[model samples]
Every structure is written in C-alpha cells, then in structure tokens.
Target: VRVLRPLIDEAGYIEAIEDPNAIVITDTLANVDRIVAIATTFDGEAEMDAEVIRFTYAEAGTVATAISEVLGAAGTGARLSVDASSNVLLVRGTQRDISQIRSLARAMDTSPRVAQSETVSTSIYRLQFGEASIVADLVRNTLTGSTDLTNPVAASVGEDPANPDTKIFAVGPEAAPISPVSVQASIETNSVIVRGTQRQLSEVSQLIKALDVRRPQVMIEAAIVEVSGDIAERLGVQLGIGENSQTGGIAATSFGNGGGALQNILVALGQSNAAALSTGLSVGLASDNFGALIQALNTSTSANLLSTPSVTTMDNQSATIVVGQNVPFRTGRVTTDGGNVTEVIKREDVGITMVVKPRITAGGVVQLEIEQEVSSLTNQAVTGAADLVTNRRVINTTVLAENGGTVVLGGLITDDRLQSNQKVPLLGDVPVVGHLFKSRSDSRNKRTLFVFLRPTIMLTRADLEKAAETRYRRAQSAETAVQPRSILKQEKVRKLPLEIDGLY
Candidate 1:
C-alpha cells in the first residue's frame, strides 16, 4: 500500500496557517446553532449580522455579561443576555462581525483546562472512539505529563455532547521535532487523529486501532408472514357468509394456505354446497309432489334441495356401474450405457381408476360413464355351520345427456309384497276363527339404482355465487310459498332481505 502525503505541503503551510475566518471545530461546540446560522446565510445577499444568539454553558453568569460589554466596546452592536431558567447566554450582533465575536468568546473562555485560541505554537490532534469518554480520557492521561501537549479538550461530537467520547488536543513543539518524518491527523472524520512525526503517528495509530477494534456482532431476524391488511374487513366471518352484500359465498377462494391451491376448497364446499348436486326419485306416489319437487329443482327456489337451474334428471329401468383398477405394465428395452449394452425393463401403472370423463359438445351435450359399487352381507349355512358371507356388485354404464341434466343408471326394480301379520297369542291358534283376531299388513318397495347429475359450467366467482344463492334460497323456501323471482329481485336491489326469509 502506498502512503499519501498531506495536501498542506511545506510551501503552502505558511499561507494556510495565516488565513483568517477559517473556523476549525475540534470538539463539541458550546453553541451548536451558530454553525447552522452560518450555513443559512449562503442564500442571496444574506450575511450573519448582529444576530441575537443564545448560548448555554456551565460557567459563571458574569461571563455572559462580560461578553456583552466586550462586544459593545468592539462597536459591533452585539448584546448578550442570560436566560434565568436555563442560564444560557444570548448574544446578538451583526453577521459581518460574527467572527470578531467568536474571537472574543475564545479570549473570554476562562476555563484553564480548555484551549483558549488557535496559534502557530500548537498542533491539533483529535481522537474518537465509540465508548463514552474512556478513549479520550485514556489518550489525555497517556500524554498528561508530557510538555509537548497542552489544553487537551475532550468532548463528544454530534448531538450528544455530554458523552465526551471524542476529543481534540493541541500538541505542538514545546521545542523542536525529535525526528524528520512528518505526520499529521485530519479533521474530516470522527475516528482517531494523530499529528506529529511519522514514527510518532504510527505508534499512536497502532495503539488507537488496538483500542478501537471490537468483535463484530451477529444479529438474526425471524421470518415475517405478510398478510393483506384488509383480510379482517373483507374475509371476516360475517362477510365470509352471505350476510354481507360484499364478499359473498364465504370468500373462501380469496386466500391460500400451506397446502397450496385447493386449501380453501373444502370451506367453499361447505358454504356453497356446489361440489356435487343431489336429487331424488319417487317411483309410484299418487300425488304431484314429485313433479313439483322436480320443477322446483329445475328453477331457482329458496329450498336448494329442489333447485336445479343447472341440473336435469331422468329415470331408467336398468343401469350399470363399472369399476376399474390400474395395473402395472412392463416392457424390456435394450439400451447402451457408457458404451456397454444393457437391457432394462420399465413398469408403468396403466388402468382405469373408475373416473368418468364427460365429453362435452358445442351443442350443450355431455356424454359420460357412471359407475356404482354395492356391497351386501348375508348369513349362510355351510355343512350345518352358520357363517357370514359378503357379496359385491359393480354396475357400469355410458350415457349421453344435455348439459345440466341427470341420467338414471338403473331401471326400477320392484320387490315382492312383504307381509307383517299380527294376532292374539291364543286366538290366532284357533283354526276356525283365527282370521278374526289376526291383522296383516303388506308393503312393496321398488328401487331404481340411478344417478341424478346436472353438470353446469361455472366460469367465475360471481357465477358461482349466483348458483349458491339460488340453492340457498330454494332450501330455505321449502316450507313456504315465497317466489324465487321476489328473492332474486330484492337481492338485486339490496341484501336479499334476510329478515323476510326468516333464516338468519
């Protein structure tokens, strides 16, 4: 590394030292606002006039009055006052003669420990460290007995003056330099400063660096999870449901969890019940109730159990449900690995998983396969020993239906008439009149293994909400005579008039 020489060479040293109005701030200022005022005068023709300035110091009050009398004698129209509460010195003077006032202040500063004035007889050195006052005190004590240094003034820089961590000292030749190599410190930084012969500064530098060096501290910050600020307002439980006019259908799709995309899907299902639509069939009832139910299911009804705006159903006599399991298939292939011939066999699972993929057409037709799995338990007698047996049934079928329509998988299978007979214990045994005391009840049950499905296309959240609202209203209106149109119209105007629905 190359060492750079100071810009103040021997040739320029004399002129630099002779320049006036050169304010060198080495330690904390008794008055900090003066520097600010000086900088404020840079605009326009502004100059520091006989500006009234306030100063606070720990010395006797006479010092302030004395400064006032001196400024008055200098004919600068400067006035000094003492604030009673704070004991601060207030000085007012013409900006042009501010430097004169500073010089007078230096002379008036009677502290024997503080340096009174800058002179060619003295060289300034500043030492700075992080610890409060300790480093400056150490340096002062280290050279306290030496005759070369005088008026070691240590004070904290910046806003905190009482800290006394940083200091400046005037050290010069009480006689002459002991060595030829020159060394000087700078005023531009808050770090250590050393001024003397090169060898002296080098020694001082090593000591200062050693004192200032400290172990680096390591800090670890925990991770932060950022959530939307409006989450509570927009996704609160009240707005999550249909109660609020905004954020309808539980707002489940608005957020995500650690599980990724499908995390809130279950919540959406509970709120909207849109996962799988359900509809039932009644074979032979002497009433138009089934028709009304189906009609209600086809339209927007408050009772969602019947509503089927996107659904249609059909009855059938017989249907099939297919079951499939994937089986691994293997194939052997010859390949070259590192210039060596090798045969490798790869096995892949390739079988149907019983999932029916519907083929949708532009004409609003959906072709799909329906599968049903049924299991039954029965008791059997094998070689005079009773045993439990299990049987499984699988039915598969492919059918075509319009979009939003249902297809029954199986035709109606009617069971034989089942009879329940009751009679008096003894009277039923009388052969002749057993019929009089006995009562018989007969019931026949018919079942059509079917699937009622209506697959409607939902493009957006609003569409889904509309479908969910229709189902919700239908479910609520099951026992009432309210019209779906009224609900829709009122909901469009306001918040669905939940009071009128009477379903909070």
Candidate 2:
C-alpha cells in the first residue's frame, strides 16, 4: 500500500484510504484509470498480451505516443512503447484493448497520400530570353509530374459469358491516376502552358525568371607577335611581353636596320605608330618615355605583328578565327580493275587559327579555355609520297585572368645555324696554305613567337559603349596615320605633271 501511494501521487491522484492492506485512489476518469492500470500491473493481476507491429512508413515513436494518448482518453488500460531501431510498436494490454489498438495502427500506418481534390489552373508564360522548349524541359526536371497518358494502363477487360456482346471491365488501383501538375511547350508561340496548383505555378514562374535573364557579353583581344634574335630578348626582358599587363592598347618598336622594313610594312598595311602593333607592348611602357624608347629600339632589332584580332561573344560561348587557306592533300590511292588509278584527296586547313571560350566568374575574374594553332605547308616532301608535308605549332590550355587584364597564352622558339665555304674544290681540301684559297662564312637565326590574350566583361550598356569607343579611337588613329602617306603620293603625282611639262 505504501509503495502504491507514491505511484498514485505521481499520477496526480489523492489516495483517500491508505491502510496496511488496502489503498483507494480517486481522480478524473482518465487519470483514475491510468493509476489503476499501474497498480494492477504491479500486483500481477492484469491479463496482458504483448504484440510488436512494424510500420512501413509512419514513425514508430510518434505513432505509439499518439495511440497511447487515444487509449488513455478512452479509459482503456493499454501500454505502448516504441523500438526506434526496428521501427516497431509494442502494445501491452488486455486482448480486447490490444485488438482495438492494432486496428488503429493499421489505419494510420500508410505512405503519405496526396490530396485528390486540389484546385488546378492553367497559365501560359511567354519567355523573353530563353527558348520555350528548353525552359519547358527544365521545369519538367525540376517538378514531379504524372506519367504520360499515352502509356498503357494496368487493367483488363473480359467478355460476359451470358452475353457475348457485353463486356466487363476490371481496373487496377493505379489505373489512370492524373497528376495535379503538367507542363507543355509551344515552340511556334514561344511560350509554355503549365497546368498546376497555385504553389507549383509560383515556383515555376520564379525558376523561369532566374534561368531566362539576359546573358552577359565578353570581348576577347588577342595579339600574335613574332620576333627574332636581339628583338626577342629585348621584348622578353625589358617589355615583359609574356606577363600579365592590364593595359589595353598597342605600341610599336623596331631594332637596328629593321626600322626601314618595319615602316615599309606598316605603310603597306595602311597603319602606323602604336595603332599598328600589339597591345601587349603597351603593358609595361610609361607614356613619358614611350616615344624615346621606341626610337632607340627602332634602330636595333626586328619584330613582326602577325595578327591582332578582337572578337566579342556571349559569356561561355566559343569564338573562332581562321586566317589561312585550305589545301588538298592525298590520303589514299585506289587502283581500279579497268587499269585506272584514283587518288583520294582531303583538304586541310593551313594557317593561323584561334578558338577561345571565356567564362566570367565572381569579382570580375575571367577563365579562358584557349586553343591556338599555327600551321604551314612545307616544300619538303618524301621521295615517293603523294602528299606534301606540313609544320604545325599548337597550344591548348586554360588560364585565369582579371577582367580587362592581359595574359600570355604561350610562346614558340626556334634556332638555326648555317655555314658555307666557297673556293676551288681541290684547293678547299688542302690544309693551312689552302685557307687563303677558301672563304667561309657562318650565320645563326633565332626567332620567338608570343601570343597574348585579354578578356573584357561587359555587364551593362556603359561597358559596351566604352569598348566600342576604344575600338573607334584605334580606327581613327590608323586613318590619321595613313593620311600623310596618301598626301605624299598625291604630291609626287602633282610634281610629275610639272616635270614632264618642263621637259617638253
């Protein structure tokens, strides 16, 4: 009785009678029932049956607690416990109470089901920047939808025995269940028709807006420069030709006796001064000394600007430039039974080419994947071969650079030495005294090629306008440079008429 007092007190019941042999507890119907169940279990007088039921989907602990509360409210003396590891519920009570609990558990333990009466609506969303078919596919992948109705359903039909024309239909539980959401794309109209609930439509609208925004643009500027001997050394060491320089302009310099050749080439191309060369040189030069330094180098070494191409493309899109021709080469020859031979020729590109794909990242950094190649047809051919040989230099790599910054893509260097002697054939073979009869000359040629690339990201109209202005300025400078040459030619023509008249 004393031990039962503590249990009754904990159950919020007052024990009205406490004796050595009997104890009486009283409370609300639910609380009194719970206290009596506990005392009966302690006294070994309650008939209890234990059953373990495993749930397939519903959580065991949550279900057990819910069932326990319901049984307590109904004044049923049942004990429920959960085995979380096995996801099973343990029920301990009288046979009738356990039976009721099992029934309730079976009704509650099921996979979550969707509402069959949800209100569905259809909406047509027109895309501004993205293709309708593409956006539709993206939406389908993002949301769960029903299978196509065109697919066969799991059902069968049988003819009635009594009446041959009568038919009996047997449908499976899953037959012809329609989903609450559906999406279709109309390519001709450039819109998507979506049938779904309000929540689903809202989500689809947000996703389409995020994916259909305008794509940014990128301007890629490339420089291909070829230098030889002392010019290559000076460009590499002093000008930092292969380093990253954030400047975006062109500069020209010549070395030794190459000034005249450089000037002639520039004139022929109708360009002059800085506008005629590569922007890579402007990376390391100061404005105050730019002219003086170019003048000094103009008298020493020679360099050539092979090509300077500027291209603009959408971000993450590829741009290609080819500055050469396609030449045919023999691939194979087939002899026919009629005593005729046929040659299989394939055309291959021979010249300079560049392919670049730029991706703009956070903080205005540009990641570039570049493939550049310089190939040329060679005069050297195999003795019995039908195809001519070729020399190819290729660079394929990826690098990171800041927006409006320049980076060197790669370089190719080659060296060749030649020696020649002229004398009487027999005299050249004689030693010592034969030296006067023979003259020997030796020469070396070294050349280096550097490729520079710059990427400029344009996120707004102002950026694009700025880029266009820069290019316009360069064009104007080129036109100004060619003006003087044209004037000189005009003056020469004018004087020719005067000189001819005076001679007459």
Candidate 3:
C-alpha cells in the first residue's frame, strides 16, 4: 500500500479536477496514457476484475496507484486489486451494477480528448440538462415521472455559443462525502454524465436520450470581398452595362458567361456541376460579384460546409457618406400668442441606414424586401436655408431563377466620387506660366456593388459525418503531415476580363 500511495494520490487529484473517464491523449507515444479495464456483473454488486494496472510513458510507475484511488471512490462495487507481471485493471461487479463498469470503459473510449487525438473518431450527440429554463423543466418532469430514478445533484443546458441551434442538457449525481472517483464530468466534449447506482444512471440516460433527439446540422459561411474601383468599372464595360439612364451614372448589370471568350469557362464550370454557373447564368456586373465563386471553390467546399443544401441570403444597401458638408434644417416654436415661428438652420449631414428582409421557399425561390435611404445636400434653397434631400427606394421582388440557383441583390449601390484640381491663385493665373497655374480639372470615379446569394438544403447527417471521416483518413494517410515550402518565385495571378470583338 505504501508503494502504491503516489498513484492513489494522483488518481484522487485527477478525479478532483477533470471528469473521471477522461483518458489523457498526448502526442508523446512512448508515454503510457492508455486505460484498460475488465468489468464483471453479479446479482446485486459490480466489480473491476483487474489483477494489475500498468501505465507506460512519463511517471508510469504511479498509474496503478491512481487507478486504485479512482475505483475506490466509485462506491460499493469498486475494489482496488492488481496483477504485478502485466499491468491491467480488473473490475468485477454484481449483475445489477455491472453495466456501470462497462459504461465507464465505453465513455473513456468516446471521450473528447480521445476522439480529437486518436486516428479514428466516433461520437453520438449528447444533451446537457439545464438547471434552469424550459429544458430544465422538461428534465425535472421526466426524472420525477420515472419510477426507478432519484433526482440529480445538478442539471443544466450547455448550448453551443457559435451555433445556438445545437444544445445539450447535462445532469450531475447527488453529492457524496467525497465525489465519486469513477464518474467524473467531461466538459470539453459536452459529455452527459450522471452518477448514481447502476439502475438510476441507466434510467436517467434513457430519459435524456428520449427527450432530446439530435437534429441534422447545417453550417453556413459568408464572406465580403471589396473590389477596386478600376477593376469594377472595367468589368462593367466589358459586360456591356451602360450608364444609369435615370441618374446618368452606371447602373448594375447581370450577364452570363455565354457569347464571350469566357463561354468556354462556363462550359468547364458546367462540367464540374457547379450549380451557380450551370443551367442559367445571371451574372451581375458589379464589384465583388465573383467573390462567391472564389469563396465556394477554395474555402467553403474544402472545409466540408457545403455538404448540405443551404440558403444564401444577401442584403445590400447603397447610400452616400458625406463629410465636412453643411445641409439645411428648420426650428419651429409655438409662441404664447398662439403664433408659430420658424427659424432656418444649416446642419452637417451624417450617414444613413437600410434594412431588408429575405424569404425563402421550399423549392429554393427567394423573395426580398429591400429599403434604401439616400440623404444628401440639395443645390436649391427654401425658407432661407439650403434644403436637405432624401431619396428613399423600396423594392419587393422575387429573384428571377430556378430552384437551387444564385441571386444577386442590391445592385443600385455605387461608390461615386468627384475630384477637382485647381492651380494656385493670382500670379499663377497670369499668361504663359499662368497656363500651368490656371489649369483646372474635374474627374468622377464610380463602382457598382452587388450581393451574391446561394441557398443549400440539408437532408441528412450521414453525409457530414462521412465527409469528416474522410478528411481525417486523408490526413492520416499523407506521407508528410507538414506542407512542403515552395522554393520557386511565385507570380501574382489575376483573372483578365474577356472582350467580345471590338466592343470593350
């Protein structure tokens, strides 16, 4: 016993800190970090039938002591006995409590630490019972109704911070003088841990699983890529989108890869079964329009987020941002004489906000409610004040496309800027030298903005699970885990706009 005291102390320490079932997995292979146990069940008792517990790696000598300490704290059926020649844990128990021992072993195999570090991975959705909230109420009601189970010490819902839709309800066992050594909470992987006699834990696990059924998960990702003004304008001209008829500026235009040098590219895209480019091509001629294409091929698909059918919703609003400009306002007062007085005031213009709502149908059609407000200073004056004018545009329409297609929204937005240059004053305006000084120039730069959207539908969970498994297999099968650094000079690549005849 004195020789095993250190292992017992270590086991007690681990039980106090992390969940008892958490088997530590590390990159150091020589270190012994494996847990093995044989469980036996009898009439009313359970036992760990281990003759020896051997732990290799760093400080391996203390492993048996820790395992003995952990099993001892597990309550009634747990006894610490070991074999000297081969270090293996042996646990034995009565028929009724035998399942608990088996559960402990299984839990260790499925622990998050194990799954993440091991070459093969496996997991089942689990719910963490909440102490408060509707979920908690449900657990309480279920536990109370169950005849074989007693109330748990603690219960709470653990919701995924990134995805609120995924949640787990966790339950804790009643508090004993010393916390049970065998049944420990594994928080990293959100394991559902309940401590009690074999029967009670079994009852609670059933109830939780029955109430909380895992739903198929879908992940959505979006990116915003800003295009340079020069690139946007060139794209617009190549696509044959003329100046905006009403505003006398460039209006957003959509075209396909058809009838241009890019026609071959579109054919290639179709061969790859790219839904965004296949069937019909409604290309919106604007800045950042093709960003979705780049994003889909490189990052989103590679990350396994594109497995399910999903919906892509885009909201874009166009407005002018003005600074150092004064606009008009009015102040009115109701006098005691029952007469109204108004004073004109000039105020600096600030910014504007736009809000839009998107709706999707089962067949993948989308409808959007877009509202845009543009505020600017007016050239004309009224009531002794320069006027502040606001242009509000409201649009409600369905995207002109078939199901599972791409849609472009908010094309009216443009970054329109005006620049002016003037020579120096008086002397600079004189004769020959004045010619240089008196030079005056005005120029305008504009780029149209378009939002691209794609929606995918989630059908089942098997696809996502398979994709993850495949990725893991690929990583493991690779010859070298590290990517080889290139020694050659890399050239920056750009997609050149295609020209049709002499038009562009």
lDDT of 1 by residue, 187-278 (tens): 35444444444445555456556666432211100010111222223223321233222323342212111121121222221324322222
Best by TM-score: 2
Query: lDDT score of model 2?
Result: 0.66
* Model 3 stretches astray by more than 4 angstroms: 1-138, 141-207, 219-277, 281-404, 422-427, 431-436, 458-462, 465-504
- C-alpha TM-score for every candidate: 0.24, 0.54, 0.29
Best by lDDT: 2
| Winner by lDDT between candidate 3 and candidate 2 | 2
Candidate 3 per-residue lDDT, tens place, 459-479, comes to: 346545543443344334343
**Clash totals, every prediction:** 32, 8, 60
Number of clashes found in candidate 3: 60
List CA RMSD, all candidates: 32.4, 17.8, 29.3
Kindly list the per-residue Cα lDDT of model 2 for residues 18-74, writing each as its tens digit.
456455676567767877777777865347788998899788998888887776766
> Using TM-score as the measure, what is the rank order of every candidate, best first?
2, 3, 1
